[model samples]
Target chain A: MLINVPETVVADALRGMAAAHPELTVDVENRVIIRRDAPVPGKVALVSGGGSGHEPLHGGFVGPGMLAAACPGEVFTSPVPDQMVRAAAAVDSGAGVLFVVKNYTGDVLNFDMAAELAEDEGIQVAKVLVEDDVAVTDSLYTAGRRGTGGTLFVEKIAGAAAEEGQPLERVEAIARQVAGASRSFGVALGACTTPAKGSPTFDLPAGELELGVGIHGEPGRERRPMMTSGEIAEAAVDAVLTDLEPRNPVLVLVNGMGATPLLELYGFNGEVQRVLAERGVAVARVLVGNYVTSLDMAGASVTLCQVDEELLRLWDAPVRTPALRWGM
Target chain B: MLINVPETVVADALRGMAAAHPELTVDVENRVIIRRDAPVPGKVALVSGGGSGHEPLHGGFVGPGMLAAACPGEVFTSPVPDQMVRAAAAVDSGAGVLFVVKNYTGDVLNFDMAAELAEDEGIQVAKVLVEDDVAVTDSLYTAGRRGTGGTLFVEKIAGAAAEEGQPLERVEAIARQVAGASRSFGVALGACTTPAKGSPTFDLPAGELELGVGIHGEPGRERRPMMTSGEIAEAAVDAVLTDLEPRNPVLVLVNGMGATPLLELYGFNGEVQRVLAERGVAVARVLVGNYVTSLDMAGASVTLCQVDEELLRLWDAPVRTPALRWGM
Candidate 1:
């Protein structure tokens, strides 16, 4: 691991974030990162968080047109309810707050508790759970489908709605709509080693791959020998399209799982586009890079969200975050 | 290799770029990506290219405020002169063009030949060579320092100048100034495997790392047992600051070499900032992410460029590229 102390990984990263981006107020003590201009008077605030490994998803997405506050927990562990409640209190204005929770056992439980706590404090709170992973009905840490790459789409689109001064109810509806309309599938070429472990999380032989791996290295559908990018794309896209049965143009996300370079991800995306075209599916937009990730895991994930004109417009809106920024 | 065929890796990635970014006209056959709104009246055009592996370097950087055109060669090889000449002709308005060439011998030679060819065709051309890697005086691919992470800084600030309608001479001078004022040092935790070779580029045993490594796995100053991020930051910052005794504030770029995760990179950045503070160097701005890369090598490089007020203004200028986008 390229870290000084495994236990201090999240805190150290927060300090670095504070230094690199003075636009955000990083509370290392509480493990929350909030936009400096948070608590916009008449705007609904968006909050999302989970374990620490999947970066740029929650913390890096905190800015003007995205998350207002992100609570990062220890690596692969769910954040406590206190972090979420504190983030809500810090960012919530009179307009209320929305919590975007990924559907993991611990995260869902913790966020549910935080929502109750926030409401007790007289802050109106709404919740949207993202469970767009189509790989399994249940996983190691999830009762239902695991939330994977589709969380990015939900955050981005819903964030735009919030930034435009939509009420908390409308923003929650948009977030839920995005989560329900999206599907994701991941394949792991190799395992990731957590800082505390100092070794591979799972045994993934060099010549084999996990076809539908979970983000936390959970067991997937099956193991297979190495496949070409085209083959992998065909399987992944088919997995997503079959389940989604989208009637509208889809936004495509070709995401890297930490260690996969853009070179390979872009090549894979080309194949993915070919497969989608063959299926006569129109792609509204395509994003190719790492957004959601496992720590140094060699793999890639494909996420597709069926978007309406309104959702597409929101996706195109200006955002000014650290990891994802444009149109500012 | 996450590609259909090793020989067509670059082509496949280009096709994907064309699909992803409609604002950039990707010429797969010509191996160049140009802004769709090229030949912007009196604006000086910025052109850059190199081997395809260091992605998002030249190609992902083509947009409104960055390079006007980018030519991509096969992995680990310099682009030919024809591509550069073609790009020059396509984007050269009456205001002329500037070529940002890295210091690899093949790149320098090919760009030189292309500059002469473009001049013969009645196109005004200026050149700035980036040789900012302070690891070794000479290495496997160059006679002087190797061009690495500092290329991002040069492209950004110089591209800002070009976008502001600076003459070709001024843009070239700014680029040269940035290249001269910058220093970079890299550390590799592991070796990268190229698509063509389909094997590790070099041997890096477990529990070991290479300090002062080049972007392409070139031999570094020494190999030692793996060090903590703080220790590594101390050595890297020392290497850069010792050679660049700047009297002005510096912009810091903590760049990932493909396989390193943001989690580790941010933790490492924290350590880097501590060292810079201890050394009493004020940082005007900092960028953290993968801008330049070597396939999927697990490592990072730190780049520091001294900045004056004008240079800082240019650096803060809006850039709307696929990779680096802000202030737009």
Candidate 2:
């Protein structure tokens, strides 16, 4: 459904998130940070957020091990500067705060503005913009690339790095390195309904699926006839592999776009493993399921991250987010 | 798409699962137990299983705080007697093992046969059949109500009781308490496509949704006109409330039927909360997301557990399953 009530969407979503996760405390009045606990004194806090629909994204990912704060926006829309400023202030420790943002025009602009505002408050602030989606490379009238699935990996790896007492610059550099090594490509079998409008964002026929569809249900570069599970897996993995060139061992994520089945995801992951093995790429780690979703759209995305020894070790570090937690 | 390959479906799926969760081993050749660590030497082990399509249900739920073994069946079809026999043997400690069987006829019969077989080996065995779905009251035609979402809660709570060094009878009692106090009702917005069939299990209209649908995409108690989020929530919650008089604070689960969004689930949870409040029912805990699902059918289920102080404590205990983990 096309939900048009953009003004209250972010606030309402945040309220819902806070209610769902009692561990998270949201400053609903000011659209500030939602944290599991107050930032540790003298610790360089980490704050992140972007669009709303890709939930459990910045919000569910917020906790002790990951984000100190998350600022949510409307569905597929960027959060404004005020929300980011509030989030930054709420999470700023004496050591400083770092902003981890996706590479979107509105997100970059608003986060940049928030960083400046925080600087005015005598808080040291640094920003790292994630541009990892390989779907779009170059274009006028648009950002260079859209940040998609890789944001999760970067947030997690960087969050671990920060938790280990890394400085803001070092954390930002590690996050950028993680982002640079990751690439994702997705396909949509159907369009999602924006909650307010109560209608689908786009029309897709029963037998047709879009290749390389954006998370916002935006048109992909190609619309092809429906293919078998293996064919679709081949297409998606090929796109991600060609873009990322994972000649070494890599962490693979076969993520569902909201409405796909875990069965299908596993099936797709099997195909991905086969294809990667055939191409002589070792699968070091694999995560298959709904990590980052685009509402209830029937689709899936493949993400590949080439990992050196250090990257793999960082990936193995304990993470304790509500969505992804292991080891510790 | 429907995929028919009855003979290989379960094994293939298990292979994929083992690959995805390297921490858990899948005995594809023998349908045995999966343990993160070696089974306790003298403890009464617990093993469970049924149909395979319920990803993360009995399988994803196997870990530290849950099952010692899970026997998977073909897609939506129950496993054969031999599979259960092997499962029972694999996890049998010197003390014995408990079989947590769902209420389906195939599951009960096969598990019963397995129990008999295990008895032949002089192995102590106990079985607790779970029938917590409130959709059906009569067990004449279908061996009673089909076990649904309540199985997870029962298993977790019972597993906790077992982990606490409770005897077989005590663990069984706790499992029965969970089953007796819990009730679930599901609605399917669309039919699930069996991988083998490549077509939906059943047809659904564009705007209509089926209420009380089964996990295997079985026809629900009713297929009604599509309504607002509030209306659907009211209907689901009403069904659960009517089935059980939950006086104490209750744990409510708003579960997606594979294809629904967390946004809609949260919206439904809000409506459910409002309805329960109108009825003076207090919600002690709430979990919203795709916990148990039927492939990619767009729908949801609501589960209510009447919790007392003990059950609440059990619910609060740490669980380390792949799907539901908290506290720890």
Candidate 3:
């Protein structure tokens, strides 16, 4: 059943989340962050955001050890410059604030504009744009490749770097390195329903799946006949591995596209582990289930990160967001 | 794609859960719980259990402000006396242990047997049997009306009472009061696939929904033609409100049956709030989302509790479990 949702009501969902989780606060009027307690004067703050619908992403990732602020846009659309500007101002400490953005054209332009706005206010600002999705063929133009699953890994590792008191430049550099070292590929078993349209964002036959699909319900490189779980895992992981051929140990993520069950995710992860073992890939870390979702789409994505010693250390650090809390 | 799952793997799933959440230690060999520190010295411990397949119910609810141990059974099946006895021994402090049990025939019998075993060990024990589901008509003989959503509220309130260093008798009394004041009813939009069976646990046509469905995939009170979201919410909330007649301030939980999205749950909550407001029922707290799920069944349940001042305070207390954490 399709329900027509208003474009602006996307913020209502974010407000609902903020109301439910008091540990996090939102600027409903200005799209800023108030730190639940607001105005932490001494800490080096970090702010990040992009499109909405990849929930528990930037919003759920906001807390002590991760992002200090997240500016959200409409569904699958980049936040406007005003939102990022407010978010930057709200989380800026004397040390400086860093913005982690996905390398999409709209997001890059808006965040760049916001960075300028923050700089004009004498707030030291740095930006690290993630462009880790390997599915896009041409990197020279058209947003120069899109950011996808690797954004979370970058967020966690970079958040840890910042939490450890790294300088903004070093943290931004580390975030960029993580993004450069990661690759991802996804397959959509069914198209997602846009809240505004209530119908599917795209259409696929009952027996077919879209391979290498984008997170925004964007069309993939190809659509293929439905295959076994093992086959799907092979295609996704193989594509990622081919792009980032790292012999070093890696972190593997078998992420759900929102609507898939954890049970099925486990099955998909089992297939991933089996294939990686066959390829003699050394897996240093593994995370399964919904980390970044595309809003009720029946699909899964595989992410591989070529981890160095530094990356591994950052990955192991404590994180205390509403969604991904570990260690402390 | 019906996949046949082995029934024996249900226990394995529980073991996996214990492994996943280090906060709750599990005894795979004995199916028990000792603290991560292995046995708190002198506090009176609490243990609870019932059927499995209700992810994060008995298992997820086991934590600091909740049960000290939970004995999970086969999929939708009751745990044997041996499992419950082991759980009892592992959690038994010198002060004694309280068993918070739902009042199903199998659950009562098994817990009773376990209590007797504890008595033989010279370990003091008490039991609070919960029968809060209001859907069943014959509560006198027919399995005492089948415990449902109220199990969560009972556990939370009773857990708080126990945390306050109350004696076993008082804790049991509080639990019983919570059970008496709460009522719930649910509608299943679709059947869940049992992991072992690989197929759905029940059959429902595309347009039909089963009302008053049990947490363990038991047949609901009735199956009627599927209706709109407003209609379903009306039926579920009406059943609960009629049973409890909660004229006082209440906590309303619109819990997903497992697979329903937050989008639909929010719509359902809207209907629930609208109906309760029209009926002059004041809602003190509202919790919507998948709290107690039946694997991947697509449906939701409405639970309303008539809270006294004490109960309301307890409900507002801090909890730090993996599933439900707030005010902490």
Candidate 1: pairs in clash: A328-B328
- TM for every model, in the order presented, reads 0.99, 0.93, 0.81
True lDDT of residue A38, candidate 2? 62
lDDT per residue as tens, model 1, A20-94: 889999999999999999899899999889999988778999999999999999999999999999999999988
lDDT per residue (tens digit) for residues B1-328 in model 1: 5778898999999999899999899999999999999989999999999998888888999988889999999998999999999999999997999999999999999999999999999999999999999889889989898999889889999999999999888999999999999999999998999988888899999899999999899989999999999999999999999899989999999999988889889889999999999999999998888889998999999999999999999999998899989888
* Candidate 1: stretches off by over 4 Å: none
DockQ, all models: 0.81, 0.40, 0.19
Cα-lDDT of candidate 1? 0.93
What TM-score would you report for chain A in candidate 2? Answer: 0.93
Q: 1 or 3, which is superior by DockQ?
A: 1
Cα-based lDDT for every prediction: 0.93, 0.77, 0.74
Q: Model 3 chain B: which ten-residue window has the lowest total lDDT?
A: B1-10
Q: On residues A1-328, what C-alpha lDDT tens digit does candidate 3 reach at each position?
A: 2111454445445544544455778666665544564346566677888766776677778876678888877767888988877877777777788888888788888889989998998889888877777777543323666788898888889888878878788888888888889899988877776667766788877668888788877777889887767788788888888888888998887777866655355456667777888888998887765677776677889889989999999998887776677666
